[model samples]
Target chain A: MTTDDLIARLTGELKPVPRTAVLRRVAIGLGSSLAASATLMYFWLGMRPDLMTAMETTPFWAKFVYTLSLAIAGAWALKRIAHPLGSIRINLALMGALIVAIGILGFMQLAMAPPEAHYYLLTGHSVSICTLNIVVLSLPLLAGAFWILSGLAPTRLTVAGAAAGLASGAIASLVYSFHCTESGMPFIAIWYTLGVLVPGLIGAIAGRYVLRW
Target chain B: MNPVEARLKELMLASLDGDAKSYGVLLNDLARHLRFYFMRRLADAHKGDADDLVQETLMALHTRRATYEVDRPFTAWLHAIARYKLIDHFRRNRIRATVPLDDAQELFAQDQSDAAADRMDVERLLQSVPAKSRDLIYRTKIEGQSIAEVAQSTGLSEASVKVGVHRGIKAIAAKLKGGADDDR
Candidate 1:
């Protein structure tokens, strides 16, 4: 049909679109998802025995800051990227800077520690379990992210998914930290970061299939 | 810059708020724009598909209207969707639509054709790209060479060649949009 003909037909069939309750959905979705994950972590694994003392330690706070920063950035990016024309370049750059800072701090701590303690710092008390716990805890958040994104029109699906995964993983790491006993700065910098990024990679791969509208 | 754009943005925002009349007008204006946009990019042989793309783009905009950010520039969002529809068309018929060199020459030689003018516009836009990337884009886009073929001819990995071509097109689009500088 001609353009004018198509327009006429479309106009005749036009229906009013309801206002999108995106902001409300985001608040409720993320808030409840985080609460559920936190509750599960609290009851299932229990808080670390020295929870009060850990709160006072700089290392513990460092880990918290690291994960929380990622969580905030990723969440913010996800919100904007729900639009087809949204650009996440700034958020991605900030995230990159955070990684570099963490990496530098990790190496510095390693340098200061004695040679014999190097392996202990690198290996940590919990390697496999920490990563797995972060991934598991991120499930609810990831689901929430998917819910938020799939409801929108994100053209860059892989990037949107990666942002969602990053947010989920970071939030998971923050909750997991309450139960984790590891205080090694280097270990947190390395393994904790990996835990968050692993899900990001998974999200990127799955985005093509899941977010294909 | 123009009142038409400002008017379109207002109509779009109104449409989001359930103003069916404004939505219809907005879609009608967008359809006209898309017809021109698609026609400029497509060859004469594929001119029929321009209307199809316009229809498809409008349908997408209708369904995804809820995602539109009122604060952002409307044209950017509109163009992004239009570009994706164009890309989807190219990908769907890449093998069949890749014009041979001889056919491409004939197609461009006809100065009277709108396709030839569009081709010239594309070339001028692409002049901003570095020499190497321009050649890669020429081979892949105009010559219709596959990524593997381009890679083999240039002795670059298929991945890099693909990236180069993608970046080149993106750069050209950016320039066309009046972006200050090339990021790549």
Candidate 2:
């Protein structure tokens, strides 16, 4: 009816909302989706057989750090963009630095290795299916992030979508790492990054249509 | 931040704590500001839509209150939501160009013929709704009467009055959509 009447109704029904409501929702969305992704990974692609041995290796830890850092950056960006007028520049910068650092590490590894091993480092054993798996695993996480975003205020739909996509991709990569035996920095820099980007691209496009209030 | 922003932020913080009175005051202040904000961007011919937009934005602010971060500048968050609602309104109306606030004077200079025509069309559409619901919608929406007032006058419960007004609006909207589809 009238603005005054609407305001009256709104105030009348007002309840004390928890200060951490948004954070809680984000956590729930991420936690459940992560569990779902992990479950899917365990069923579809069992963990690496040399689980005890891989834990003590440098390359394995490198892959873990790279994916984990990216996931954190994506999450930071997503949280920021979930608010109205929230800026993602810092988050983007952090993510960019992480990628460059990984790239540098991969380059050094390639350079030190013999030229004949260059192809092996880059392609690893699963180049054909690595990116595909990451993309597929990201679907559940992407859905969860979108669900969380739909309930919040995000002014820049495309950007917010991209953040959600990036976060989902990174987190998916982390989950996929458990099953992946490839320890090459070059493989992770090339294929893992692509897997993350594919979902980010999908998120940007789908967000424009789905993230509307 | 300005004193106004500080005060609004304080009120919002209180409102989040379930202080209804403070919340009401905050909403009233916001409504005044939003009226001026929407009135400026809208063309003169479509000024009647300004209040509708204001109402829509207020509703969004209410539903998405949890998204407001306590540490962030309150005005920036409010402005973003307001601008988003305005953009959505423009897109729905297929309004490609907007009158800048600087040229708001030009808005008053334009004729009201289009608005008058729109009112007539709305009156025609209102006829399709049932008489009881139509009366409720008219009293509450056009007359700007409170739901409680309407309910008391009509001997109907407030909930029923609310439902009647809601149904009436939905019926009119459905008819308008049908008309647009026929034109297409």
Candidate 3:
């Protein structure tokens, strides 16, 4: 074969990568995050033995209103920063906003605590606080990692990132379960939401660099 | 028995006898024959898919050899596998046959034989290119892919893909032009 022929033949070869796998990974991340949130909410309800009574009171209603406002704002920030299309600026911005939102939420919880406090509210055996923190902190980190990793065009990087995020989340969730035996269902829903969010964010940031495929 | 069939049978036997390395050598040689088989019909010689099909077939053979019946003629089974792998490759890559049934007979009988000549030329060229160059060539041209896509798919640095693609193209071009130019 002559050089020109070889060049022409070589010029025509192209590799095919499958798109379906990337989409599946993203779907899994979203489902996992939603489940973590539900668990946190379950434990939250158990923490405040008097939460139902407080719900009937003015202060309880006020805190509820405040928390609801924070929730909406957090959701908005999440959408803006984690734009579905995925740009670096949008991602970093999203992470920064989420951290701020979580900080505010932690402070608000302390503020809403009653002085006469149910032993559960103060040094509580309640699973509510722990679940809430874990869920809140972990979701973003793990979710971000999985979403970003799977999108990279390189099969190896995508596979590696996916495996790491999935394994870590599984491990972390097990560890959290042992620590939050007292969390109310609602607490678990909220705190676990935060926990996952943190790891998800870390994963996302790391994926941007590693999976540049 | 045909010489090719006898060779393939020998290759299979060697593979089954625990000479795993011989299987690869057999597949490499078999790929050349497969290329010739497809070249008779493929119009675009550079449509690197023939090679892809050959590789896919070899993979299927390796993975599913245990199912092969010793009592059956080896050529029949090998040809069936080759045909199946070719179809599988098309399905996976979304390639379609443009000639409908109404046009098929006419196209087969009256079509220009240009594609066959080009396919032969391409096969010769491909067989001579270095392995690395061949891979890059296959990724860029036959796959009809962008450099970024190729890099992403292959997990190579973008710089490496760029350099490799350029070098590979130059080398193939040089080889095709014969020994006349040392410009590369």
Candidate 4:
């Protein structure tokens, strides 16, 4: 159908978004996700005195570092919040940074000492399992993705969100390629797509309530 | 314009004058108009960017509405909003600049399947030539406005319009052929 037909069909209910409200709503979303991530880590790895005591002995700082990094990054991103730039320059710029970081991490993996029994804090049966731990460790960055998608700009529908998600998924897969082993690409692609899809959905749904302006 | 279209136009015009009824009308009109706009685009697209474009346009219209002069033709204002929104669409989808760590082809080729996406690309090649020249084609071909109307409208000699159209057509034809080859 044509745009005219589409308009004719649903002409009575649309509302213009207010810019201030959208910004406020996005801030809330970011704040909530930050709280949730912290809460999750606290329960999973931090709250228990016994766990913390054991963790101090374990000498493995992966989970703690990852969680701490997430909180720090969230604070850093929140500090930079300002007016929405209608241009996609910022989105493209962030995508570039993600790409570079992925490459740097990839090179680090290749240059490092050969296989240790455990890739991170967790033990995995294979590279795919190890990759999952790495993915989990990237939560702070994933939260950043949420912030970007939510705060960037509104799209036409869920489709735009989906497209953005896929673009992100693809770009992320590219970055992951440089740091991850050859065996990890396909699984990374699939899981990364899933990871990106969630934000796209949130953005699209919230676009109705938050990003209209 | 039908009732809804007429109503929207009136509401837009009235809203300019600070009529509260018009504001509601505008929102209703927008909500109604956007759903179909997004839906149709989505229907044609292999990817659902049509939806994203819709919300973005709606959001932009909301953000940028203050810049619109209530005195101008509302249609012109509406079309302008559409054009800017389209510009944003291109910016989002275009090749992102990055530090080239990998082959350009590899970075682009992998994980992308936009070839499967079918968004209408209305690149009317004839539009690029010139409106003065296009007048000839419109008169003789599209509009059937005779040579006399073409001359009067453009303030050019009829003979000149005819000659320009002929030259324009030849150039366009060659360009299309080249474009076709490039596509292959």
Candidate 5:
């Protein structure tokens, strides 16, 4: 058949697509995943035994603010990176700034404290499992993000996957804060950032396979 | 930057809003463009097969339209789909002697295979050429720059730029063939 004839036959019985369907679907998926992760945190991990006392400390609030900021920035970056040709330079730069801020906080704490306290501050109580917990908690959020990508058209699969991973990791850390007893700025900054980045690295490697249409 | 591309972009945006008329119009325009695109690449003996490629490409575009990034130029996305169809067509014809065309058809019935990998391999192959020649080849072939423009940018005579690009492409093709042979 001629091209004109084909076009007519194909588009003749078209269904109207909802506007912003991609955005809406992904947003809904992420929201549900976040709720599920929060529930998991509450039950599986349980709120820290000293929740009331911990909240009273400046370090506790600082850690919460850091994770929350990372989560929000990561989520926004994920949405923007969904576009294949869309630039992620700004998003990456914002992440760099957040890391720098954490570094400054760590430096200030080091200068104010004595040498004997440095090691303890750096290790806190959960150095061994801190990063691992972040990755484990991120599983549900990563699955949901992948599901959303499957429904939409993401051109740069590896980058998009990494962005999703970064967002998921940040959300996982935010949830982990409720259960984690670590109070050192140095420990939170170092371990929490690594925890968030591990999934992003994994996503970059696996994105080509999983996110490909 | 072309008017046709701008118009196509507008239609695509409109179609996303549930405008069937705009969608139909965009597809019609694409079909017309694709006919010429495929015809130019196919040999005289296989020219008639361009319509099949066109049909396949159109179906792919329709199915994968949801993945289109709104801010991207529509032509770039359309061209990527077209390039995949062309490569598949060429690969099938090349191995037609041993691979029964019908059997091959069954294997490739789903056209959602990863074209990015192939494109990336081609890019990696291009990197084997030296920097100056590689830049020239990229500008002329991938970026669609005129030989005169490339020469001007690199401060070379148009003749030298043309020769460099031609040799660079030849080198890449030879290396790629060698790699394929090793794989086999």
Candidate 6:
């Protein structure tokens, strides 16, 4: 068939698309996955035992803010990348700055503490399983992001995937924090960040194939 | 934004509002723009692929129309999609930009010959088609041969020749429509 024929067929079935359709899909995708991840975490690890006291502590809030901020930044970047010709440089830069700031905070805390406590601060109690838990938690969100993106127009598939992964990973870390008892800035900076990066890397690699549409 | 960009953006917004006439006009306008855009960038040997690319890009645009943000520049979005289609075409066909030393002078030649280009395009289009259907299409469509003549020439029945042409066109159309679904 000719191009004009194709255009005619396309225009023949016109329907008004809601202005908020894309955002709504994004919200549904991430929100539902987040709910699932939370449920999974609740059943798997349960909340930290000293939940009330932890809520009052600065370190808990610090970890909360760091992961939440990263999640927001990732979502911001994902929104931009969902559109054609959208750039994620600003979002990436902001994420980098957030990580760096957290890293410095961790270093400062380490410097103030005596040398004997350095290992404890860095390793925490669950260093072996912390990153793995966060990654597992992010799986649902990552799948949801990929599903949403495949239906959208993301020109840079790799970057779009990475953004989706980053956002999902950050949110996973946020959920994991509730159950994690570690209060060290250094542990959160190192292990939590690694958890987020693993998903980011997975997204970047898988996106090239999954985000083709 | 320039006047053209402003006008196209207006039409696109209208199209998004279920205005079929506006959407048709916008697509018609985009088809011409994309044709020129692809033709200028494609190599001489692959010029025939421009129409296919144009159709594929338009299909992509139609399927992904919801991704267009009303506040952003429409032209920029269009350009990005167009560039992506071109890149995808190059990757699929493995078309290199290298010019043979003997044919270097052809790069500067300004001959606007249509027949030769059309033949080249027909050849490129048939490259991936199955050999039997490819030959049938080449003979009946490109060489202006009758179905009976192609059948006799290839020792196949006339019914098969007709079926071959029909299936070949359908295959090409299906290839163009691949991955153009909304998937929602």
> What would the per-residue lDDT of candidate 4 be over residues B66-85, giving only the tens digit for each residue?
33443344544554454435
lDDT by residue (A8-98, candidate 3, tens digit) is: 3322321222324344444465457545544553554224455555556654443333333433333332322221122234333543464
Worst 10 residues of 2 chain A by lDDT: A78-87
Report per-candidate DockQ: 0.30, 0.59, 0.02, 0.05, 0.25, 0.56
Superposed Cα deviation of residue B134, candidate 4 (Å): 21
Q: Interface root mean square deviation of every model, in Å?
A: 2.4, 0.7, 15.3, 7.4, 3.0, 0.7
lDDT of 1 by residue, A55-97 (tens): 9999889988988998888888888788887778888888889
What class would a CAPRI assessor give candidate 3's docking? Answer: incorrect
Top candidate, metric TM-score: 2
The residue ranges of model 5 lying beyond 4 angstroms of the native Cα positions read: A1-13, B35-73, B76-184
- Candidate 4 root-mean-square deviation in Å: 16.4
Tens-digit lDDT track of model 3 for B16-108: 555645565665565565565544434584366666555555555554454344545555665655654444445455667442222112212
Q: Give lDDT tens digits, candidate 6, residues A131-182.
A: 9999999999999898888778888889999999999999999999999999
Query: Which candidate do you rate higher for DockQ, 1 or 6?
Result: 6
Tens digits of per-residue lDDT, candidate 2, B84-136, equal: 88887887788898634332223223334556788898798889999999999
Order of candidate numbers by TM-score, starting with the best: 2, 6, 1, 5, 4, 3
The superposed Cα distance between candidate 5 and the true structure at residue B86, in angstroms, equals 7.5
Poorest stretch of ten by lDDT in candidate 4 chain B: B103-112
Per-candidate clashes come to 0, 0, 90, 15, 1, 0
Predictions in order: lDDT: 0.80, 0.89, 0.49, 0.44, 0.78, 0.87
Please identify which of the two predictions, 2 or 6, would achieve the higher TM-score against the true structure. 2
Question: How do all the candidates rank in terms of DockQ, highest first?
Answer: 2, 6, 1, 5, 4, 3
Q: After superposition, how far is residue A46 of candidate 1 from its true place, in Å?
A: 3.5
lDDT for each residue of candidate 5 in A1-213, tens digit (9 for 90 to 100): 777777776677555566466677668978999888888888887889999999999988998999899888888777766643444678778887988898789888988999999998899888999999889889889888888776655656678888889889999999999899998888987999998899888877777778765
Model 4 CA deviation exceeding 4 Å by range: A1-19, A40-89, A115-153, A156-213, B1-184
